[model samples]
Target chain A: MIIEGKQRIWADYQKEIADDHYFYVRSCIRQNFFPASEVTFWKIIRDYVHKDIFENEHHSSCSGIGYHSDVVPFTTTQAVVARQFALMTENGYKNLTSSCITSFGVYSEVLETWKNFPEELERTRDILYKATKREFEVPENVAHTSDLIFKYRNQINDMAKYRLVNVKTGEPLNGVEHIGCHYAKMFPSKGVGGAEHPYVLAGMIESWGGRVVDYPERRACCGFGFRQYFVQANRGYSVACTKRKFESMEPYKPDFILTNCPGCPYFLDRWQYVIAEMEGKTYGENGYGIPVLTYEELAGLVLGIDPWDLGLQMHQVSVEPLLDKMGISYDPVKKYLGVDNKNIGQPTCPSVLKV
Target chain B: MGKLYDMLKKDVRYQEALKACINCGTCSAICPAASFYCYDPLEIMEIVQSQNETQLEELLKSDKIWYCGECLSCSTRCPRGNTPGLLIMALRKLSQDTGLFVESEKGRQQLALKRAIGDNIVRTGYCIYIDTMKPERHPESGPVYEWIYNNRDEVMKRMGANYKGDGPGPMRNIPQETLDEIKKIFDLSGGTELFENIEKYSEQKAKEMGLQFDETTDCEYFNEIFTKTTKKHTL
Candidate 1:
């Protein structure tokens, strides 16, 4: 009965879930920092969920960064979103899924703004019309890709090739689920379990047989606030926020950090390196850092994709330790292999700070 | 040009982000910025709600307003459903729009951000491009990144990304038609004008500071703003 109620709640939580077809929008940071993660996301939607996804090169950014950075106003942002919607309408896909949490939040706020002031929609319409003679119908179901992943966690678990356990020890790997704040924090109800106990990443962690370790700073922001991190003067607040989260979570000694948002994974991973440089501080056992992966990359790893193929080498904190625990084998030299399938010699000895 | 209070009343962001404060201090308590910097979102809200034009305008010119990470964490826990993060957004928008953003150290970084992100948006259809993600700018990306910078195509290709390829996928070549459309949207939606105003005011500030100002991203003022770190928080 409890199981039934749980499924029922999930059912209601994702009532408007896209029907295996989506008009996909990309995240700029995701492609930059973790290119293969987005590629892996597409593979998951295709191979695991068997969803029909349409990705267009024409789908420009949601301009959420510009708007939040204060260089762009609401009118410009709304029009950009409307332009995206018009493209989706042109493509005939009604269910829209954004890869970035900020874009998802921006779209949600724009939807609210349109609902509150109908004239704003008309204003966007005029601009879009002037630019592309484009008319748009608002997507019936606006969802984050993470939300979709959360909805299908059970189905994904059934099809998993490997569980999140130490293959050598048969112990469940300890993991922390860092849900991006924008996923549900701004409007709690939009998220799977709302803000306080957002299940978007947690559900994925559990489904993959990883023990979801809870820490005091679980709900804190990843601190990649567009301006906060971008401006050197304001970066302390960003670094401090990330440091606070790392300090609180370090005691748990999780094997890896898993996140849903684009910037969260990047900032959380990058700042771990920055904190080491700035303070001679390091987390995890033996001065090795925590390997942070997106939920998609984690899923891809468990699904037995090649580690290097997922751009794990691009990660500052190596994933080899986690891979060894999982007994996943790969030719180490391939970490430097070119498209010609030849080793390109060792990468410049990683210029890590010596504390 | 208009009374700032009247303008605040008209902005939907101000209307949506604010509510009856009840002065509980929850927004400040939850604010990540408050933990590190001297920011207090509750105080910012109290000042905004009090509707003192001088103070509000002062906020527009202050480094304090740029402190919000826009994480929206405060909005989640606020008992009154008020979003101080969104309020900060409204404040930032007002600051940039009124040309008062040039007054603060943090706000001066707007020109750098505009070149780095805003111009990148127009040129690449994304906020950042891989070629421009420099080793100088991104020391955190470290030496592996430098090596990858030397061998980006090879590494990216092995990773199954379509870096500057013909068709649509990760890192594919965004067609000129799409870029043209994006430019038209910016021109039509006032983003272009906003960019102009940012440059116009920033140039004035640069001249005032006796710093070199130019159309390119490598001006002396730009380099100074981009690379300088504060000793205040280094401890």
Candidate 2:
């Protein structure tokens, strides 16, 4: 229950807006796990926000997980990140928006490390020049896509059709916002609200009219420690961390969990499924499981996008309860429509705890 | 004439990651990895600070360092601003570089990880490809994904994804020029060298264990290491 670090006021955490043109580097894991969220993010930026976001085929993984896992050396990671910046320079993008929080953290860390040690930066620059026969300029601004959304939350709110309240009950949806650890912890000053009181996800929730739940472990890691999750033996640690968050927040009786991190939403949703299987337990007010959504998914919902279109069916812990609460309508039997409407079948049966 | 601890102190991450070790135990108390596994960040720091060659070498050969998820939760809470997560990173690097990683079960999986994630990057710009997440390998993706894969073209069209067809869209084919550029960077950036190191060290370990150690990602040794699970550090 102990709050850590020097807490910053909301005013201290204002992020500078990136230039209208952004070179986006998508997270490899995000695309595989929840492609819909990424799609929705691009759609909102282009269609709703009217921003110029660019994704060239040249962008690659930040090598963050690989670097952290010790397979890739620090030099290799530094050079790889430099290549990304080179791509940005080649594409004439002054703003860099990374899709994955981990990639964002890696970028931040590389920048920070380079700041402290210019020699490493020179080495990376030289290696990159030799690697691609290309020269480079660093982006003027670096922001996670979540940061962009958080920075423009009020604008998004202005266009939102549905509030974060239940339509039938006319009550605010109680929400718990989980910030990705890397989003702030790596460098507190760079995050939305600093490390002690990050408000990236919270800002989105509040902007969308949800009642934010402040729990003891609000800042706890989603526990997708790269190697921890990759190695099955270490997954207990990953699950234990998620369990701690769930246990800490159970008292709040929140309706849903929302996160900005690619790993957080998946782990939060999947761990609930794991906990249910391991110990016949459910925690949300409805007693099935709390529906976990990324910030983009929440935005898509507020924009009146159909529930199934957000790929809620791909989620292990059902979002049906939340969808029902929101009164978002779609055919239940027809929800499992896969690519090109081949009618991909659904899970044979629904959970007993289904609302 | 310098010890391994001395070498670590020379590393920038170690220098920046460790400010001053006050032994507050805050790092360990809040560590998620420590809570589930027989691991302690503060204790690891204590061992490292002791600068004993035997303990440091033992650490390199042990499975303990592999338990840290590198979440850097310790980095945020450390009163002295010493990040055990970053310290773990330093230790893991030293472990792998010295071929000591092959001694531990988790360390042995480095080859599997290289094949899965590292090689995936070279093949596709992604560390994981949608096509690779087969139900057999990742049943956790659930049955919904199985049906979705069987009818991806239809599902992707409905969901608004390009689904590997082409043109600027999510999940579409990454331009070939980009793939070539990525491949060249990997070769120039020591990534290929690191990959080879992983293969060589793992092969040595596999040979010592009397297991087949083919250079290819496939084969008995790679499969077992990838699939095998351990409870050695479980609480």
Candidate 3:
């Protein structure tokens, strides 16, 4: 529990993250759940940070879900990811950044697998060539999109219109930063601040004027276990995982939960509503569950992006309370409206949780 | 070494994941699955280390092998650098390979995964498409998700996504050519074969269990595996 000891280890895990021109890949689930988060990322990087980021419409899902769920073979995952590297090589980019933490882990695993087993790497090359007639040189750098955001946190803060602070109280808001296990747990050296005390999200929390909540379950997974959630009956395990984290963090009274993983934020956000419905429990103040946000959405808010435009409305648990706490304004009427400004209709509220 | 051990030894994940086990409970202590389910990664490792064919075979056929969330939390804290999570991956693969996965309730769900995620990849180029995420299948997502599913086009348009349309953006309709390429990669890389194995074994198990099997998702066997749970899964 030595703070200085953790700091030293965190410093040791710092990677030489690239600053520009990364070939990007999208998550299969992230876009479906938080559609605008990636769009918000483009706006922040290309529009705000003034950096070069490229994506291929041809590149598809990294097959991490299939691979981890044990349907896709490791060789298949390697070849599929090799095709991604081929797309990058053809498009002439050397850096790779994926929006999903699972894809980040897949990439890290593939890279490590290749380094240890050149025959598998050769087989992957042959498979990619035979299938797509494409040749690939592995990217010079690999990073999660959040790592890129963390690298430019100071620049984002430099242009901040709002911060993670209670404007009324003038005290920094407490945020629980949860890292995806795949981000570093499997391969510690691949991540920003390693596995145990990851600083990727924590760095953003600190730089954006928020205090990090060191809850007992801070390092615990958000429990969007692919098969666990994908299969209906096993959902209890998934919800229970979220419940454990929420119970552990409740005593801290954190203002919000922040995450880098596609699944983490989705589960952390949606499960609160589910938990309240099932058990009549709520983690946040006064029947409102704690607001969970992706790193991009948090950045979008700090950059004065409209709450509705950032797609905070997609989240099951409402972000309104946290927005209000930060003194960020939004037209509550516009929350459920379409681009045509017509009411799209609202979801039925849960019994115990506010939406 | 026995048959099961021989097969496990061939898997790169098995080779990389299990180095040495001192029967340390660190992996089990850190495992989220272990906390909820009656699972012990330390015991799983110890059994694997014993090289006993009967124990390993029993493990492959049991619900215990399927309990891991694959979070790889067990991969991080092993004093011997033994990644029990990766070992679980290897054991699960062997389970599927030998048609033993259908013996347990959780293991039979492999067919559901093969159809949902595995088929989705070959068909849609994305492992999950919005059209497939029906609220009935995913009740945990709740009423908001149902609304979003119903009004997805407008919602996606507002979010600036292409929403199954062409060109680069989230949830955009992946091109047919790209889908073909992905299918080909799977074909050459043993994914299609693995998928076939899951189907072949699942269908066989369904017949043995006297459940209806069909090509589509709506079948007695799919329903059973997708919905079946035992109280033993939880504390």
Candidate 4:
């Protein structure tokens, strides 16, 4: 289940889970495009949630992004993931959670398949063991942030201290939840529900007393098939898929769409406007044109967390309507996001030195 | 072969830059243009590395090559610093330089359109400009021309230029040095003759194939000439 907002989930998860030693997996796109979200999510989990997450210098990228481009070979991807897993094992972190859908999916595949494919696993283990002299075993459970959030849902709901009053027409708010493909599609048998009608994120939203709306293209990929956008002009199909999702949700007139993965929010929010312009349609009338926000941001607001503190302004589209819906007043000048912004900071990577 | 490999090796910056990729397929999955087209960035890198001439040839011949919208979303999100979009552009340059897939029908048509558009731009610094109010005098021969006519203002806005109605007017504004440079490059690339022949051949093929031939019209003439040229030249 997907619970909207940061405070409730963070507070509850902190109280319930004794195992905070997380194996944080890095995402390629998030590192480059949306670094702020990555930094923010980790900071909240570490400081506010008081989770003992561990990130080490020895860990490298999972290489799943390059695999689709056929740039990197499968063996090479296996080697990279194996190296990361070995590092995690050395650090005594048994559970791995990734912010990126691709990293989560690729790593999960490698870990889950290792048990059945001993020969392949042996090859990867031999290479890393010979190189670093470190032995590794695939964890029993590999999860995305959504999994952790779902596991600790009841505590999240109990910790909710504030309510959002939709200032837009003085009514309560409704939301549409976006279930990321990587999280939902990684393991079909684990039964997180089918990728198309994933109840993980939607269930969390409902638990928060927010209604979840299902759109026609609810299962459509967020057109972020990585290198496909850059090399070709076929964005029309991806945009159309996103447009279908918006059209399906339009009937509900949702206050905002909430997502767990950063990439989905970027594509769904920005591409919604682009498709509207291409088809000569305005956003609110024929299209829901609702602003997209991360589940953390939504939850933070309902718990009376400051919008700026939640990094709400980092979004491409204006979050004023969302804030208005949540009955929160924000000063545009005071909340301006810039280099000096308090909410913005370097990632937890050792390469980033705190000023 | 050594020289070519050396050249590629020296430009190993592109390869090393891309080493950081995590293989998330995010670039391919999010690519808008890749959704409908057969072009795959990952495949391009594989072919580039393999130096497979046949694969390169096949890639250049496909219509998917021309379908890129030049959006930089892939580069923006690519975990590795590689820009597959830019890599495709480099391959396009290679295709034109080597003449590997120039005989394809779409290739020839594109060549013709490029020449016609280039020449029109050179001569007038603007595409075909006729008063929209005088529709009787300016007749469109095809659906393409009709669309251009209907969306002239929109097209102009998109291109970010204005058309002046003065005689022998806008062409003079472009620098003579720039025009000479363009011509020199066109000659060096053998594009001028290729474009001319394309137009000539298309018209002939249109008639020979029993296709509607509107030679009286400039657009139709150009289309037929290019089609015929492509048909005549297999390799």
Segments in model 1 whose C-alpha atoms lie over 4 Å from true places: A1-15, A350-355, B229-235
Q: Report the lDDT tens digits of candidate 2 across residue range A1-355.
A: 3344333335576667674888998887677767788899998899998999898776778887788767777888888888889888888887999999888889988999999999988888888888777777777899998888887788889998778888888988899998888887868888877888788888888888889999888887888888777655456777788999999999988888988888898888877766766686877755678999988898988888877788777777778788778777767876776654555566644343342
Show the lowest summed lDDT stretch of 10 residues, model 1 chain A: A346-355
Off by over 4 Å in 2: A1-11, A285-287, A350-355, B1-3, B215-218, B229-231
What is the C-alpha DockQ of each candidate?
0.69, 0.61, 0.86, 0.03
Residue-wise C-alpha lDDT for candidate 2, range B1-235, written one tens digit per residue:
2478877776678878777899989998988887788888888999888889899999989988888888888878888778888888888888877788999888888887787778877777777676765656654444455666666666666667766756666677777777777777778777888788888899988888888878565687887787776546677
Instruction: After the best TM-score superposition of candidate 2, give how far the Cα of residue A195 lies from its true spot, in angstroms.
Output: 0.8
Ranking by DockQ: 3, 1, 2, 4
Alpha-carbon RMSD of each model? 2.5, 3.2, 1.9, 18.2
Better of 2 and 3 by lDDT: 3
Clashing pairs in 3: none
Query: Which lDDT value does model 3 have at B195?
Result: 91
Ranked by TM-score, top first: 3, 1, 2, 4
Model 3, C-alpha of B177: deviation from truth (Å):
1.0
lDDT of 3 by residue, A84-176 (tens): 999999999999999999999999999999999999899999999999999999999999999999999999999999999999999999999
How large a fraction of the reference contact set does each model reproduce?
0.73, 0.61, 0.89, 0.02
Q: Which pairs in model 1 have colliding backbones?
A: none
